[model samples]
Target chain A: MKKERENWVDMAPDALLGYAVVVLALVCFMILLAIVVAGVRILTGMGAA
Target chain B: MWHRLTLEDVKVIGHYLGVLVLVSAIGLVPPLLVAVVFGEWHAASRYLLTSGIFLIAGSGLRFLRVQPGRLSRQQALAITGLAWLVLAFFAAIPLSMSGHYANYVDALFEAVSGLTTTGASVVQDLDHLSYADNMWRFMMHLMGGLGLIVVALSFGLFGKGSASLFTSEGRSEHVVPNVVQTTQFIGRITLAFIALSTTIVTTLCLVKGMEPARAFLQSLWVSISAFATAGFVPMSQNIMYYHSLAIECVLMVVMLLGSINFTLHAEILRGRIKTFFEDTEVRITAVWLIAIVMVFAASLAASRLMSDLPAMERRGLFMVVAAYSTTGFQNVTTSQITGSFASGMLIIAILMAVGGSAGSTAGGIKINRLAILGKSIVATLKETLAPDTARITISYQHIGRRPVTPDIVREATTVLILYGTTYIAGALVGIASGYDASQAIFESVAMASNGGITSGIVVPGMAWHLELFYLLEMWAGRLEFVTLLALMIQLVVSATPSSLAMRLHARRAQRRRS
Candidate 1:
């Protein structure tokens, strides 16, 4: 998987590489947003119980 | 020892400034066309009048010709510092006549806010404002976010002193060897991003059931605003007017892109994805943002500002991103921000203060400075613990692995101190204008950081003194203090009486002789 990722990074053209970075950033933000939402849910649920 | 501005210096500065004004006059054409297309004859006439004034003033100033050569360091600084104010003055002319502002000062405030990319507004009825006026406002954002000098440099306006003028506007990095090519590359990259983002946003706007024309216009304006990280939305309700999760998410991405350093953009564009990811600014921003977002969420949840998790995810998350980017797009209204979310405002203020990457459109002390300061602390610790004869060297990765020299540390700390002082001084002025402490600090940070987040204190009828102070804060912040200080020092020296100047020169000579 690491090799494949490296290969993809190496092979992509400039425009594609730019868009790929954007996609990676979007995924990261989504994960972070999910964490925040989940953490708040757990905290609020604990408080209510 | 400071030298006063000679006549030659004044003439050269005036001539270049005239060139810049002429460029700014061209900026009016689009808005004028927009007015004409919409059949807003009154607005078009106002634009025509403003453009006519710009032409006359610009041409008149151009007549002050000193043989064209490289701009002196002082000359470059003066032109860069004066350019923003002059453009804003001319830019405000049509806006003041727009009938949406209470007075000329209010229009000028809006113009400064737009040019500084602070996103604050004092226009009375933004929703009812004409297309021409709205276009003008966002055009200011486009010009200001690109740095007025940068835009001029991209057009090959200056010959020899372009580098100094470029740095004078607080831009230090060159993606390309030549200053002109670098500026042009920056422009090309900006337009490409804007084009891509606008297409995506216009699609989302259409999906949200907006009319085709309005959707297109809104998307274009917002694409410029977000990519510039300038916070002005066409609607008065700001981003919340849309309430689409998808639109907000896209804008968030664009805002982050806007605030990322241009060199990183260049790297990405060159397919150096690995280098781009390994960038010190990128890594630091990632960690800082994740940690801050968590803390911001906790603050919101603890305050019971919004009980629902979805609300936390939507409003809380978006505001944190917006604040950190210094983009000033708010999902929450002023009352909610100043009332229920009051405590979280400080976190937002801190985020604005620590802003995004240096050499980007975003303002504030910047992440690069923060990283340097952090390394300085660690280096100090290492030095203290090392043996008496030991020498410690620290390094960090930006574009490459570069040693952390004292000059770098000093530059970072100097800017940090300047930003700190300006924030405090602005807050004091806000307090003197009778605002509460938190409100004053938040507004001051918003102004000084060019964050543009408001807590209801920046209204059309705010005290003239406070309004003027905010304008100065925005101006100083956008110039990043050093250029502003250079301008100020030169102004003071020029204004000194000739006898006093002579006496000072004599005293210096006498001291030398002794």
Candidate 2:
């Protein structure tokens, strides 16, 4: 049972790495979105006022 | 020494191009019929004049009596690039003649965008545009999406050069052994899907309180746009004009179908159901789409942009799917999209850049190249980590589990870099023209990947140089890079005199004496 557990742990990084990559991508996208939304709002608000 | 191009090369390219032009003229017929039916005599005359021009040019070239022969690789590439340019020129004629565009360049931009399935439009007052003219615009999407060369080949135009010409247009797979059969099969599948989709969308539109004539014409246009993944709308408000979820759902399915490789459709039709899930590019596309939707939904939710979870999911998923499929149908107006979805715009642009499956109407880096690049990355990592004696073999399922080779990796990387550089260059040009960086990059990716989703950068009266730049981007992106490179090389080789080397040598000798 312990050996099997160790085997699973050995396989975890590849799975973890995939998830990590996805999370990183999501974070980057969210940050970019925030910046764009903020920028557009400020620009449009200025134009309107 | 590089061999100089012979007169035969020009003749051969002209011969096939003439045949393609004639085939393109037939595309004008459907719009002409629509014009006559609608009693739009002026639009009909424009179509007639354009068709006549195509017929005359085609017939004159055919009269040259250039014997048909196998096209050398360079000639095939040249024809592939030149055919799109020539067709765009002819298509613009009718568009300009309609007086909808202020100038010829705007019409040409529309033609390029339409033919490349880029979906960007500069024509204002789209709601008031005549039905025949509207039909012509969407027809360009259908022809361009199916590939003009494929259409000509379907009519049994070229025999020996058909394969290379087909490949040059960015299609690599064949449904059948013969190129002509493959083209026909693709056409038949497209028609079948369009027919079914139009019926369904039209019915849904009627159920949603739209008038019968408007419903029918809009359904037809949307069906073609969806199948081509072209994202053109007869109405200026786009999909938002209908305000129907059923219509959006139907269009989403059609766009997904359009983005899938046609060969996969053929395989499924032939009872190879496993091929759909087993295919590498399709699998990557599926995963990529899910991730994008998740990211989009999360972004919308995090920002509290939409009023509710359902609204967020609906709008977010629609945009995600549209971008993934490279179909530019928008439920929101330009202002709402930029204002509300601003946070997610970059995500959408990235999805557009990744694009749909290869060998489909969609464009971008293509899921296949991305998959190959992914596998190559894994292979390199394994080789670096393993012992020196270890043989690291990487394989992925395409048609089969093909082993990853250096050549494949190099080809994928080269094209990816080319697309990336071109994308950045377009953005730089846009920034130089005084547009904001984010909007510029977004529009550049949209244009480069043939995604019609716009950020208001592409307008009726933009800088001519920028318009020309986007036009070239659409052309280059649609043909992928190799064909354009071949065309450039061919032009240079043909333009240079054979004695230029001798002249250079004489000049060098004189310089040394002096």
True contacts kept of 1: 0.41
lDDT of 2 by residue, B194-226 (tens): 998999999998988889988899999999999
True contacts kept of 2: 0.00
List DockQ, one per candidate, in order: 0.28, 0.02
Q: Candidate 2, residues A5-40: lDDT per residue as tens digits? A: 685466555534543443344345434444443444
How well is each residue in B41-92 modelled by candidate 1, as lDDT tens digits? 9999999999999999999999997786778889999999999999889899
Q: DockQ for model 1?
A: 0.28
True contacts kept of each: 0.41, 0.00
Per-model lDDT: 0.88, 0.83
TM-score of chain A of each: 0.61, 0.62
lDDT at residue B343 of model 1 (Cα atoms): 71
Lowest lDDT 10-mer window, candidate 1 chain B?
B300-309
Supply every candidate's count of residue pairs whose N, Cα or C atoms clash at under 3 angstroms.
0, 1
Best DockQ among the predictions, by candidate number:
1
Query: What clash count does candidate 1 reach?
Result: 0
